[model samples]
Every structure is written in structure tokens, then in C-alpha cells.
Target: MTAVVHPAALPADLRAATIRTRVTVPLRFPDGYSTSAEVMTFHGLADGREHLLLALGGWEQVLLDGAAAPLVRVHSECMTGDVFGSERCDCGPQLREAVEDITATGGFLLYLRQEGRGIGLYSKLDAYALQDQGLDTYDANLALGHGEDERDYAAAAQMLRAVGAARVRLLSNNPDKAAQLTALGIDIEEQVATGVHLSEANSRYLAAKRDRTGHTLQLSRAGVVRPAKAAAGKAPGHSGMLARVDALVPGLRARAEEAEQLRRLPAVTVQELQDAGVFRILAPAGVGGYGLGAQSYGEAVRVLARGCASTAWTAGHLTEHAWMLARWPREVQEEVFANGHMPLAAATSAPVGSARKVPGGYAISGHWSFASGVMHSQWALLAVQLDGVRLQALVPNADLQLLDAWHTDGLRGTGSNDLRADGLFVPGHRMMDWAQLTGPDNPGSLLHRDPLIHAPMTTLLNLVAPAVAVGSAEYALDLFRHQLLMHKERNGSFVRQADSVLAQARYARAAGAVSTAQLHWQAALSLLPSEGQADAGLPEAQRAPFRLSLALAAEAAQEAVRLAAGGSGGSMHRLSHPLQRIQRDVGVLLNHPTLGIDPILEQAGRGLLGLELTMRSF
Candidate 1:
């Protein structure tokens, strides 16, 4: 690809336009092919909207030559198809093919912002709903008071002229594009044909375009392409569970205050979660659980947290404990899961207890604090030192005594009380060595086929609390935005809080912080090893970075929540306000032992500096 110089001057007629060059960068494709393209923006076109000009290869030079006719494609923006890869239309594939074709030969592709054939996005969605009601795309637009094709080419013509393209070989199946551009004083050297992109979802839409719009392309109706089916015996996907949880969010948000007041997740909320099958996310597939991967589980937790952080926190820990319990001996797993229903377990790994080894098991006695969800758990996985080895002993709730000592300013609804166990005898099958559980070749690795069950405990355990923090931050941002819309100055000024520039800046900062944290969290989740891969844990160099990323995620959430609370007025300080609760919850979550920033940063710095690790437990 050759580079072309930007024009030094524009013609008298185009001088008054609000045209500016935005960026020129390499656009990479999935096939490893890349090309440089200049992204020029034209602001004063089509309802004061901005249109983009992607001059590929040496197209700008070709256009400046006046006699040379560059290949041009006038493309319309489709948010769903282009950004989301939605197969409801061929827009995404067509856009990809056009970029490849234009890059091969010097050409220009104009990305017009005329979404939904100029009916706008929401209207396009309404049109989609209408299309589902047996109307074609054109008729759906007409039903919405829009023309069959409302997009105009005047902007494309003006953009071409401003870029010094006097004539062009148009790449399009629609002859109307050539006719419209020609009528707008753009000389069409030739009308080139574009290949048809066919799929089951867009077959009818394509047929309508070809039959009614005079588009020239060969399309076949021999077979409709469909997505490949999942493998046999595969568990159902998480979409249904996520949708169920999403539907339950409003009710959970309504009862958040009640949960806080009761110092526990409301019984109704717990029942709703059970009904949604949320606790079974990490259960074994053979036991009728989803056995979702880490990424899917993290996403579900994030979604649940958006409504109520304490509930999400308790739920995440309990679900993760199920996954951990899968690492125990097969007999123990069967003993716990014999009922074919998901079980909730509260856990603490601080090793604040002592266990004495006996012939069959260990006599465990301890008082564990911070036992989140203990009120709802059927069992407890208490960390203890037995015969100089750290192990987790699974004791039935019947043997443990719960103390009424859960008082906290943050995460108030977690019911994270202290539990006392006095010389309880846990069977050998019910205890697991901490080292073996954290290693790659754990008992669960041999018992279950799900790789998520075998994932490194160090990495997986750190993710649960952070997931709730991320969700709470997102919820805080939403609450702040809503507050801004309703807030007013106290001195009788009628100006809305959102109208203030400072508030807008804070909102932007908070949003950016949350997005950055989510990106980091997703990156860490992606590093989990897949099924049948080597058993070695994540590389040492990556371990610290992963740990640091978890801290960053928590810190980012803290920052976002702080910013949101600051923007909310004095009323936000009240206990009834969700913002105050969210702020306090995120604050406590960020202080989690594994999610502290200083320790994580030091470890990351040590790893980057090639120093011997000071801590090796992970």
C-alpha cells in the first residue's frame, strides 16, 4: 500500500465545509492481511452527522489525478450488523469483503452514517419487529412512516468532490447508487458488481433487495446456512440462566434495603436465586449443572452484582465453593450432591483453626470469621492446619454453631458471621490438602472432565470478590446518572445537575474507569487453560500480572464508585439511598485480602524486575 499526501487546499465551494481528517491507521483483518487507510470526517453532511472516508492503499493519489477513476463503495452504517456481527443482514460480510477488495486495488470506501436506511436505529429495530410480523424490510420502513429507501447520496457526492475524486468506478449491486451519484454530478466510470453474502437470517432480506430494487447479483435458494449445533451431551448454554438472573434484578434491587436491614440476603431473594439455578453454575455436568467456563461464570456474577452487590458477592462465593467441592474425593462429592440439587457452602482460607489427625479423619476446632452466606449454607469449608499441613475440612452445618457477630458498614447483607466448630470429626474423604487443591493435578482433575474444575485455585479464587465489585461500580454509575437527571441546586436554581460540565466530566471518568476494569478482568479470564491442555499452572511471570489485574479491577471499581458518589448530592449520604450502599459495598470489597493494590503491585513489580518472588503460596 502506498501513502498519499493530504490536499493543501480545497476548492472555493468546499471551503466552508466542516471537514477534518481524523486518523490514518492500519486496519487488520482476520486473515492476517492489513492495509493503511485514512479516516477523514465530514461533519456538515446529512442532518449535521459525520460521515467517514476510508482512502485505501493509494486511492487519494488516484483521485487527485482527475483522469484516474478509483474504485468507490458507498456503504451505509448498520450498528447491529457492523459492530455486533448480527447475521440479520449481510452488511457485516459485505463491509469486510469491500475492505479486502478495495485494499487489493487502490480505492475509496465511503462509510455513510445513514443507519436503518435513514429511519434511525430505534426505528430500524421497530422495523425489525414489524418484519417479524410478516412484512418485508421495505414495507416495515413504510409502516414506520419512512420511504422504501430513505438514504440520500448527496453527502457521498460532496465527500467525493472534497477528496478530489472527479469520477469513480462504483462497487455496488444497487444500480440506484450509480444513478443517484451520477445525478449528484459524480461521473461513474463503470458500475462494478459486488459478490452476494448469503445467510439464513438474511435470505429473505436479500431476495427482496434483488427482486424489488433492481440490484444485480446472483443468489441461490438451494440451502439456508445455519449455525452449527453444539456437540452431543453438551450442557445447555448460560444464556437462559443469565436472562433469568437479569429478570430477577429489579426485584432484588427493590429488596436491597430489606436485606441490609435484616443483615442477610432476603429469604425471598435467596429463593429466587435458587429458582434461577444460579448456584449450579459451577456444579458438575453429570450432576445436572451448567459447568460453565470461567468467563461465563464471571459474566453471570457481574450481571447479578449490578442489581445488589452483597447478594452477588454471597452468591459468587457459594457457586465457586461448589466448583471447589468438586475437587474433593469422588465419594465425598457424591455424598454432598446425592440429592441432585445444588448445595451452597461458605468457606474461609485464613487457617485460623487447628485440626488433630486421627485414624479416619481429623478433629477440627476453630472459630472462623467472615463466613459469607453462612446463614444460607448447608455446609462449611473451614481452612485448618492438620499434622503440619494446610487442608480444608468440609463439615456439615449440623456440627457447626453460627454466632450472631456479623456487623459491618459495607456489604451489610452478606450475613458474613463467625462460625464455631468444637472438635468436629471430618471424614478423610471430606478433607483436601490445600497444596493439592491449588495444584494442576488435583483430585478433581482426575474425577471430572470439566477443565474449569481443574483451573488453578489461586487465579479462580481471586476472581469472585472482584466480580461483585465490578458489578457494584456499574450499578453506582447508573444510579449517579439517574440522580443527575433529577438533581437541582439547593439555592432555588433550576439548572439540572447533568447540565454542569464538572458532573459530565465525572460521569465520563467513572464510565472509563469501569470499562478499563472490565477489559482487564476479561483479559485475566482469557488466560485460564482450556480442556486437555497441559497441567502446568499459568506462567510465573503471568501470575503476578494476573494478580495485579484483579487488584486493578477492584481499584478501578472503587474509583468509579467514589466518583459517582461525589457527583451525587448530599441526599446520597442517606442509608436509604442505593448509591451510599453501593459506595460502602465497593469500598469493603476493594479491601479484600487478595484484591489489595499495594501487595499486588509489589508482586507485579518483583515479577517485572526479575526478582525472586517473596511470596510463593499462590
Candidate 2:
């Protein structure tokens, strides 16, 4: 009902804030978006500030029954940017977006008279002059003897209580807003991330906000939601998979810990992957799959890893295995795809088993390690040496025994455990020669004639590791910045690590490392043949360099994560902290045999010097 002032916290003579008046106003934006608002004025504010609330949609009725927390945006006034078409800041676009979104969702836009982050109009212009001298937004404020951000939520909180809004879903990217309002007695049910409004002029300004003030702006996701692709059955291709996987990120992130504790991907996560058509991204359209290529696969994996590394690793490997399965004989493919559904399979490329030729097949026996996605897979492809020839033996899951040996520090949700087969017999049709399978004239390529099927195995598999590294590092950076601005000290005061010069420098370095990793990762992807192009297979000379780029990217990603983790104080190491989990997960990803920096570097050197590749995979 009224402002939630703490007992003995306010002077007895202080007046209680109350709603003074309300008026209906129709609003139209430059982009032609139109909405009407019930603008309400406030009186008796503690600070005597001239604050207002534009109540939109059915906000009052929603508050009447307490059915849900209304969405709200607590925006500060910015005359130059909000009123003018200034590109130096995102304030104009954000205000427009807030009005449109809040109207649709039934909420209020609390417009406070705190210009230029609580500095007067003339002071903000002075800071802009200082910014022209190469100082960042925050540094310019400090140069003018003002705090990085001087705005407070006391008056805004008073207005919200006056309107009977005790709880809300905060629509903001700045954690400071949420932290302040939460401290001022508002129940923030959620912190909804806003769309990134970026331009050439404001890139640096946005970066400063992200690194120095912990704003949740992802430069990669630059615009709002795009138009939906054609219906699912139209074979919407790679872009469709990107959107589909993007939709699954929230659920995947929510289950990251459950996956870790179970030491395997949760069964529900597996189902969600299947429902989302994730396993079909690499499969050929002939079998009702996307028939996409390397670049698309890499992009999808990177996006998925931002949610959960273990889920990405497992799903990524499984999707690759689907493409690998198509390399088998036409008869074997028929047996597997006969059900008219994309088959889930797990594969281990390590040649660690033995096989003996039988009358109509081979009796294979071996212990395979790192069988990712095995728990949910129906078939497994194991590498075995038969009469000194390397072959991949395809066996139904029923013929093998799964070993409980998947305990590890990171990516534990991958379920990359051991599988054992004691003299198990595999049909002759299921065995594929490793050389022929990875060669240019593989059966899948002859049948489907898709460029993706003709791509080199090493080149394609290497895409996932670096993508995972880049994504996890990006997630860590976001978390690190948010904590720097929002995490609390033992005495219940804000830590404000972003105010520290050392933390800002560390954040800048880590952010740079992540950008470097992305560059290398994209370079590696560019070397692969496009989905529409015919792949004649990559030459050894090209393959070695591609591998080198991926290795470099992985190394850079690890460096970024390590830098962020190091700057994070002792509290970050707690088991419950996500940063620690990410740190551990990236550590395990870097140690992957394919991403081993030493071997990759040596191979690159050999290729440059015109020497033979020492490694079989290269």
C-alpha cells in the first residue's frame, strides 16, 4: 500500500509520497509504433524529485489480484540522447523499445528526472567534451569529479509504492538498477535482458557500459527478434537450426547444475534436444535432416555452449555421429534409418579395439573411452583394428555393456564414459574401413551428394572444441562483469568491483582475449567449404593450417577464462558459483586430444616446412 520505509530509518516529519494526478496520452514514435499511456504524477517524494510513471496496458488490474509481477523499466532522463537522434548513446532506442514492450506486457515506465546519470545537464556535456579527449564514459565522469554513476532509486521506489507496485520483472541490462531497487524493498521476480541496440558510433560506449558497469549487452546479438522462418517441415536449413537452438538456451542454462550433479545429461535435456531437431542439424535431407555444413554446425555449437558446455559437447558429438553414420554402406544406412527417424548414435574415433573375421561378420572386443551421448544413444560406432586395418564397427547398443567410469572435473554432463564389448559379433555390413569412410567417395556422399558429407573428418570435428571454448568463455565474462557490479560484501554493502582500476583492466584484457578467440574461430570456419559448394576434400596442407587455427582459438579462449577467474576473488571458487564450474569445464575442454596445443603447433610447423604429417588424424 505505501512506501516500505524501514523502522526508524526515515525522519518522523518526512512526508509520504502519493500519486497526485493521472492523464491519458497517445504516443507515436519515429518508427511509427503507437501506444497510449496513463501518465501519473507523484507528490511528496522524499527528495522532492519530479518523477512520473507511464502506466501502460492493464497494469492496475494485474496488480489488483497479485497474479503476476508486472514488467517495469526504471529509466533515467537523457535530454540529448532521448529527445534527439543521438548515436553516441543507445538511450533513444532503449526508451522507444521500453515503451513498446511495456505496453504489450502491461507495466509501467518509471521516468525519473535524473539526467546524465544524475549529473546536471551542463555537467554531462562537459563530460562529453572530456570523452572527446579519449576518455571513456566512466572516466569522463570521474574526470569531472562525479561518480561513475550517481543516480539512486529512492525516489523511483517511492513512486512505485505509491502506485501499489511492490514487485516487478525488471526490464533492464544494468545490474546496478536491480541491486538498488532490490535494496530499496522491491521484489524483482526476474531481470529480463533487453535487445542490444548497437551502432557504429556507440560501440565503444556500449562496451564501456558492459565492462565497467556490468551491463548485459551482447554485441553479438545486435538486434531484436527477427521474422520467423517457414514452418518446420519446409527444410528451413542452417538458419532454422540457429533459431531453434537459440530458443532452447534458457532451459539448457537452467539445467546446467542438474546435469553436473547427475554426472550425465539429464533425460529431459536429451528429450528437449530431440524435440528441437538438434540431432538432425548435420543429417542429410534425404533422411529428413537439415543437411547443413561445417560453418552452420560450428555456429550452432557455439550458441548451445553458452547455455551449458556438457549439453553442447554431448549434443554436438551426437549430431556429428549422425553425419558419420551416413558414411556407412547403403545397406547399413537403410538398417539404421529404416524407422524414418534420425538415429541417435555415439562414436569414439580412438582405435583401441580388436576384431576377428567371422563367416558373415566380425567378432569385436574392446574397451572404448569417451563415448559421449552413449547413455541416450541407440547405436555406437567403435574404432577397431582388423588385420592391421583401421575400421569403425557399428554395433547396436544392446550388444555392449556401459561402464560407470565417467567421473571427471568438467563437462561431466557429457556422459563420456567407457563401453565394453566382449567378443560381440557385428554384421559385415556394419563395418566400415576408416580410410574409405573419410575419403572423398564415401557412400553417403555418393548417395546424398551433399558437400557436408565430403568434408574431411578432422576438419569438421575440430570445429566443436573451439566453439565450446569461445562460448563458455563468453558466458564467464558476462557472469564476471555482473558480479563485479552486483555481488554483495559480507556486511551487506555492494562490492562494486567495477569501480576498481585493477578489475576494469582485467575485464578489458579478458574481453580482448574472447574477441581474439572469436576471430580465430571464424577464420577456421571460413576455410571450410560452404554448404552449397561441392567439397573435393581438403588437402593435407590446408587441413593442418585449419587445425592450427582451431587450436589457437581454444588456447585464447582458455586464457580469457583463466584471466577472469584469476581476477575473481576467493568467493568465486565456491562450488555453488557458476564461474568455478565454467572454469573447470573449459579446463577439461582444452585438454581434449584434438585441441592439444603442442601437437597442433608441431603439425602446423611441419606443414609450413613441407614435411609429412606426423599425426594420423592430421
Candidate 3:
């Protein structure tokens, strides 16, 4: 264990520590976000362990201007989460965010090597073991004969003073950091709360910190957003929802790798999506939803994909499932939406299950694969073959088994697991025939006056894949451009790639592809048959054209990402790079049956030639 000597014990007029070494280093994060830091080591008296201070952004200019206090963060190290991407704690994300936030302004990040909060790594792991057997983090430490928190900020205060940061805007949620520094003669101009990095694996740990240690963590599980005040001439629903999600983009991008490692959407991400009202976009306004149509829903999914494709994929499907549930019998809809909120449901039609006719309902049994968002869903929409007919069955999650079978090379965070059911009884009211569910005169249409409820299900479902594809490809292009502009080669300038004519041509081609994809997407949206009009029950000829446009959009999106990936250099091949992940995600998305270029194109041809439609999904 590292020894700690409290700075308060020393004389009030103590001298500042001398700087031992100072060096500048170019830094590259796993997400391909690049920056530089002036790393400094100090000669200190208290706590002899080596600690680092990274001066980021324009520190000298900030000091010279004296307009704002320098942002500072005294971060304690956690090897498990920080280095290995462990989900047991929020250390990794906090550290990553602190660096980026401080770098945005002129600031310092004091990376203290106080592993395990000064209890040492081994003891921390021991505490984790105790936690597994029913102990909070603090209690676990206390059980092992250690203070609830062994961390001391004496060294941190010294480092800040040595770096001439007598006053700073401390970026931390822990009040202890500010209190300790203030007691040790540092002026904490402000104690800014860090973004809450909550995950399913660390929810309890964070709660423990908040309740036990008085950390300023706003842990809102439901993620309810307050109503915005009405403004004259401002577009309502869509803009409000978009603004909420736009604010969450940075946090989502930061947690993308962590979500992938967990093989599911984190709690914080799910909450953020819920807060943004993405899941409620399809439900009728009577049920407290936005009552928006496919166009709005698709736009939101595209926006979400720019941050994390897996999240967008899962969220898009979950949103669609809510719309699907509206087609069920009125009683079932009432039950599902009785809680005054949109229900989270996951659906799968592939590897169809079998359902047997019973007295009150059907008994569902079989394994369904690729149920995206199932981990967080309260209900599962299982497509089953009953005798010779296909039907949709709504089964509560309690009745179905969720298998951790979503292991894949792409879109790993979706948690698209396999769901199993053995004689699970689903009431007749909750079951609807496949034809009626997608038909124009479905139950939802009769109940809700909104034209969206009467829209074609096939076309709406087909739009989801391309929205994710296009958004991910666009993000890839942005990352690649940033890489060319920021990352410098050993013997070349950072702008060298930007100046290359060939590189500019490639970038232009990629941009054109993205624009083309977006055009196709808009064309598809435009083709939506006007519900409550003469075209309400549109034929296959009209719908097939929509699918064709989406297929082309998906193809163009993939091509754009391919171009960006080719030019992103070898450094982006690392698993942590966002560009590489976007490439893999778009590749997998193009393989979806809804966006299959060959089948969709062939179906369009069949429709045009006045032939029968062969593609069931289309």
C-alpha cells in the first residue's frame, strides 16, 4: 500500500514541489480522437508514488488571459476498468471524459497512481469479491479492515500548487476532492459534476458511492425529461426530441467500447434513449407518445447511429415493436400501455417458433434468434407458425428465457440474443394474425386516427436498416476526415493527407455516396402511400419501389464507409477505433434481409413486370 502523508500536517506556508521532468506526447485514443498533452512528473514530499500532471489545451494562454479558472481533475487510477475495459466500475469512462473535457479548455489532469483508491490493487480485488457475496463497495472495504475510502488528496493538492493552479474549476462528482483540496489551501472556484457514466454492471456500485459517500450523482433510472416551455414559431415534437439526443451523443460515443465489451446496451445509454423519447415516437398521442410517423422515427434512428450503431439498431427495433403492439386487441394494448408509458418490446420473425392451439390461448414453444434489445425489454413479440398460419404472440419476458447468444464481430453491443420458450401460455387477446397485423385496416388504424398507424409495416421495417447504415457511414467519413486533419505522420505534416489531390478525390467520392444514399432514403420516404386517401391500400408495385430505393441507399452507404475505411490508415484497424467499428457495423447491416440488394432489386423487377411478390419480408 502506498503511504500517505496529509499536507495539512505540514506547515501552512509549505513550498511548492519541484518539477522532475516535463515532456510533450501526442495522444491517440481508441476511438481515433487525437490530441496532445504536456506530461509532467513532480518531486514531492508526501506520498512518494509517481503521479502525473497532463497540461492540455492552451494552458499558458488561459493563465495569461485570466478570464476563466483552469479546469482541473485529480483522478485516482483504477487498472481493471481503465486498462482492461472492465465494466465493474466507471473509472475508464470518467478518465477518458476528463481528458477530453479538460483538453477542450485550458486545464490539467492530475493522474494519481492511487490504484484501488489507495488500498492497493490486490485489496481492491478482494473487496470486489466481498461485493459479489453481498457487500457494497465501502462495506466491502470496511469488512477487509480498511477505511471505506483510503484515498487521500494531499499529493493532488501539492501537484496543483506546484503547477501554479492555486484556483481551479474542479471537474469531479466526488465532493471529497473539492473539500480535501480546499482544506489543503487550494481555491476550488467551482466543483463541476462529471457526466454520470452508469452501466448495468456498475449501477449498485455507483449508488453505494452516492448514498454512502455523498457523491453528487444524479441517478435517474427512468430518465424522465421535463416538458420544454412553449416557444413561438418553434417546431415542436421532433426538434425537442432531437435536441435531447444531440446532447447525449458525446456520452454515447464515449461509452461505445464499454457497451461492446458488456455485449449489451448500458443502463445509462438505455436511460438516455428513453429520456430522448425515441421509443415513444410510434405510439398514438392518446397513449402519451409523440404519435410521429416512420419518417420521424427513421430520422431519429439515423441520428442515434452517428454515436453508436448497436444502440441505434436496438433502439430502432424496440420503437417499431411498440407500434406493432398497437395492432393487437384493444384490451392487450390497454394492458401493455397501462403504466402510462411506452413499453419496450423486442421482436424476431426468423427461425419461426411453433404455437399450439389451446382452450384460452396458444402455447408457444421454440427458439427465436436475433431478438435485439431483448435484454432490456419487458415483452417479447415472438413470430410463430400456428398450424399452417403465421401469428404474432406477445409474451411477457418472465415467460421466455433470454440466452446470452449475441456473440458477433459486428454490432456486438446490440445484445441481439436468442429467446427460448417452452409451452409459454400467451392469451388469445395478445395474438394477432400476421396478415391483419400488417394490413391497412388493422386494429391500430381503427383505434388511432393517426395516418402512421395505417402505414405499411413492410416499408417501415425496411427503412430501419438503411437509417443505421447511412448514419454509421456518415460518422465514419467524419472520423476519417478528422484523422487526416489531426494525426501527423513521423516525417510529414498533419495537413499532408488533406493536401493530397488523390485523397481529396476519394473524400469527395465518399461524400457524394453519402449524399446519394440520403437522396435515396428521402425518395423512399416520399413513396409512403398517403393513408386515409385513395392509396391507403397500396399494391405491391408501389411498395416494392420503396424497398428498391432503401436497398440502393443501403448499398451506397456501405460503399461510402468502404471508401472511408480504406483511407483511414492502418492505425484505425484497432478494435478501439470508431471508424473500424462503423465499417463492421455497416457491413453487417447490409446483410439484413430487409436491405438485401439482390432480393430487393429482384422484387422490384417482379413488381414492375406484374409478377407475384416472392419476398415475404418485403
Candidate 4:
């Protein structure tokens, strides 16, 4: 779909003073219009029916009339969002939505043809081309020798004045736009906000406008805007990262204890993740599942991590799988629910198994490792080859023997180990392929396409293991600080280990790196769509980069632990010391391929340079 370019008028004085403004036009509004004149377009506006386009472009506008007043609009255009609907900016929505609201309120809109802060369309487009190469708008403009904000607004003021618009309640978010017109002898009786809302698309753009570009905006309010509507089911933790973490701490603790004790999550803990009347999270509230994260699930994972990295990691992985499982068609879920809420555990990594297609489904045989918290699970989901397809098949846990291979150096409490499915039978309906997650097939994919499934298995597998690294690092920092203070008070000194400047620097360095690494993990987890989308599988292009990010974060965590563990000197070598356990855990964590720095860095370099990323044998 072609991109839409709706330009705003230059400021009141420069209106058409530099670049050519579109035809100076007058708008007529009809009182009580139902907001469905829909879109009146300039000759060049793009179609909005396309999803990507709708997501990428601003709405179009038509002239309108109001009941109590003539609906006058500030009808300026933006080069960034209006043209590209770049998530980094809000100009597109600001231009289009203003027209829509005015159309609904029986108002007239002044369509300004300003582009790229008034440097003109060609220059603006050129700037965008440069930006795609990593330059910001300022540098891009400078590269072209166009001054920032080259817009001329005198044309717009004259057009409005010519149209007999003596007074207006200007629709605008930028105080500059409003003030400019007011100063132009066009009485802005009032200012109505018509700024584009924030989204993953235009956050950076908004920030740039308010910061580098000097656009006057009430940015505080922008952060509070929400979608006109939310998805059907959102989790309690979706509000924000901190809130999600705080809300899930209790649940995380419950899961950890359950894992530590070699059991399943208690009924209360499971129920807490579910909403009233849902059997599991997939079933609608009326069906015994908490339909959380139709809005709130992502926020839940972030916050949960802050309190306990292991718990958050475990929950995020498990919850994401649960979301995928639950999205299966309602009829399919009904059949499953017939057995009551079944406890299922999925391996974070692909199991080394194969499936042979059979009449009904396929015979599945293989064992998947690192099935944490599996002891209490009634069923095991093994990714096996069925007719050569990588299928996630549900089998009775009894059919799979626990390998008891969870003797890991860290995350000792996770109880993650191998589960063997020597040979298991699965009905056609009981088995699904990993690709069906992104395919048009699968009822679940149709209702919910979780991008989580699309994520490269290795990268995701790394996330499952690295939370322990985060947890240990955090715990280590906490211990180091606590110990230093205790030692100081006991010794009547202002400095304990920190008394030595080197030690102080060590703690600070470790703390900062650990915090940064912790945040990186949190960011990756947070980026997963609240509801898994078809793209959950990170595209091949992104896998290597993500692997690199994983490596960087993991390496950071390792160094953090190393600094702290060594900073405490020989004291931390004692088995009973918390630092010892943290050291051991962090050390073990670094061995995971996902956590290993070298491989990840190499893969990342390959991706960035567009070189082949060969899979290196572990």
C-alpha cells in the first residue's frame, strides 16, 4: 500500500511563505453528522483499508459544520507519521483523527499541506530515507542544508481568513501551532487536543518532536492515552512492568516453592492466574479461564521478573505456552476441559525426538529436557516428529519417564530436567505442529497468533535459563551491600569491603552491569506480544541479533556475579554463603549456549553484516 502524506500548514506567518501549500480550501460542516463522511481525500492519500496501511497512515478529512459553532481545525500535516505513520512519531494520527472528530461533531477542517516541518515533501521524503540509514531528522535535514521547521504558515491564515473563519476552537496538541494562528489575527477561541496517541510505532517520534524539534506539547498526557478499545482478555499484570511484577510476586513465590518441593503449583496459585469461571487462561471468563492479556499479560511478566527473575522467567515461558494452548478453538478447549483443568508442562527447548505420521495422527517418540516444575504436571507436551513434522503432542505424564537429570549448577530450585517419551500415541486432534502457530490453519492461530511460537527455539530457550542469572546477580548485589554495611558497623568503620576504593568501584561496576543485563532480559520478555501473534517466531533475520542481545545480557550477569563474588574475597567460597550459591548459579548459567557470549556475538555480527549464520555445534 502507498504511504499517505498529509501535511500541516506552515506557522501563521510562513504559511505558504516557502514551500507550496496545497490548494487553499474552505470546509463546510453539517451539524449532527454521524462521523461517517468517512474520509475525504486529497488527490494523493493512500487507501486506509489495508491493516498495515491503517496502522501506518493517518486518516483523511472532509469539511464539516457544527451545531453550536463552526468546527475549525488546525489541519496541519506531518512528514514523519502522516507520510510513514512511523511508530516513532504521531503526526499522522494528529492530522487524520482531527478530521474524523470534527466530521463527527459537524465541523469544518482546514487541510494544511505542510510536509517535514515545512521543508517541503521531496526534502522531507529525502530526510526519511536518510533516517532509515540511522540519521535523526535534524542531521538528515542538515545533510540537505534545510533549516529545522522550514514551514510557512501565512498561507493557512490567509486561507482561513478568506473562508471567513473569524474565530476557531483550533484542534491541536502543539501550543506553537495554536499560538501562531492566534497571533496571526485568527482568533483561536479555544484549543482542542488533536495529537496522535502513542504506540510502539511513534514513541521515539513523539519524544523527538517534544525534545529535539522544539514542538510544544503536553507530553505527560500522551503517556496516558490508551487504545480506543483493548483486546478481549488482558492479564492483571498488563498495566505496567512494575505493576505486573508486583502483582505476580505472590504467584512466583508459590511456583518457586512448588518447584523447590518437587510438585505442581498449588490449586490457589493456578487459580490466581485464571480469572473467574475459566478452567485455564484460554477459556473465556464464562468458560473457567481468566482471559487476561487480551490486555495485561505482558506487564505481568515484567514486574514478576523484578521480584524474582527465576519465577518471572518460568512464568513468562509457561504463561506464553499456556496462552498458545488455550487459544485452540473453543470446541477443542471444551473437549480438553471435559477432563477438567489439566496440568501440562512444556519443554522450553525442542526435544530430541521424532514423529512418524500414522493413520489418526503420528506416533511420537522423544525426550525433552528442562521441563521445570514438571513433577506435579499431569501431562507432558513433547515436541516430537510426527510424519516428519515438529509437533507438540500432549501425552500422559505417566507415559513419559522423568530422567531426573536436573542436576544443574544453578537454579537448583527450578527442578528442570529431562522427560522421556519412548513411544507415545497421540490422536490427530491431540497433536499440533510448531508451524501451525503461524499458519492460517489451527483454530488457535486464527483466534490468537502468538509471536512467541515463531521465536527461534534457541533464543527463547536461553531466556528460560538466564533468569537464574538475573536472580543470582540481583541477590548477590543485595548481599554485597548488606554485608558491607554489617561489616562496617561491626568494625566501626565508614567502609567495609568498600573501604578500599577498588572494592567500592567493583561493587558499583557490578551493580550497574547487572542492572543493565537485568533490564535487557526484561525488555526482551516485555516485547513479546501480550497475546502471542503469528510472528512470535522471530524471523530468521532477527534471530541472530536477538541471540547477540541474549549473549550481552548473559555476559553482563556473569561479570556482575564475578565482581561481587571475588569482591567478597575468600569469604564467599564457603558453601553456606549466599554469594557462593550465586556464584555457582551464575557460572552454570553462562554455559548455556544462549548465555554464552562468543557464539551469540558471532551470530549477531553475521546478522548485522548480512552474512550467513551457520549453526555451530554445541
Report, for every candidate in turn, its global Cα lDDT versus the true structure. 0.77, 0.82, 0.80, 0.53
Residue 452 of model 3, lDDT score: 75
lDDT, candidate 3, 78-161, per-residue tens: 999889988788898888888899999999999998888778998998788656444678888888898877777877888887
Q: Candidate 1, residues 342-388: lDDT per residue as tens digits? A: 77899986547999988898899988999999989999999999668
Which scores higher on lDDT, 1 or 4? 1
Kindly provide the TM-score of model 3 when superposed on the true structure, using C-alpha atoms.
Answer: 0.67
Ranking by TM-score: 3, 2, 1, 4
Ten residues in sequence with the least summed lDDT for candidate 3:
224-233
Report each candidate's C-alpha RMSD, comma-separated, in the order given: 20.1, 10.4, 13.1, 21.4
Residue 464 local lDDT, model 3? 85
In order of appearance, the predictions have TM-scores of 0.60, 0.63, 0.67, 0.51
Span of ten consecutive residues with least summed lDDT in model 2: 224-233
What TM-score, to 2 decimals, does candidate 4 have? 0.51
Model 2 residue 616 distance off true place after TM-score fit, in angstroms: 4.6
Q: After superposition, how far is residue 568 of candidate 1 from its true place, in Å?
A: 0.9
Per-residue CA lDDT of model 4 for 1-618, tens digit only, reads 111112353233333221222333333334332233322322212111100100011122222232244456655466556665565556656656665666555545655566566677778767765554335567678777887655544445555554355566677666666666665566777777665465533433554566674565543334322222222244322233234235544334323423333333444333433322112333333333454432244334434443344444455556545545554566556665454453345554454578776788767677688786565455666766545566667666777778878765555655567887655667777776666642435565444434332333333345545555665577678767765544322333333555778877888998998888877766566544455344345556766755665566667877887888777756567543557655765676677655667766777788779887787421
lDDT of 2 at 572: 70
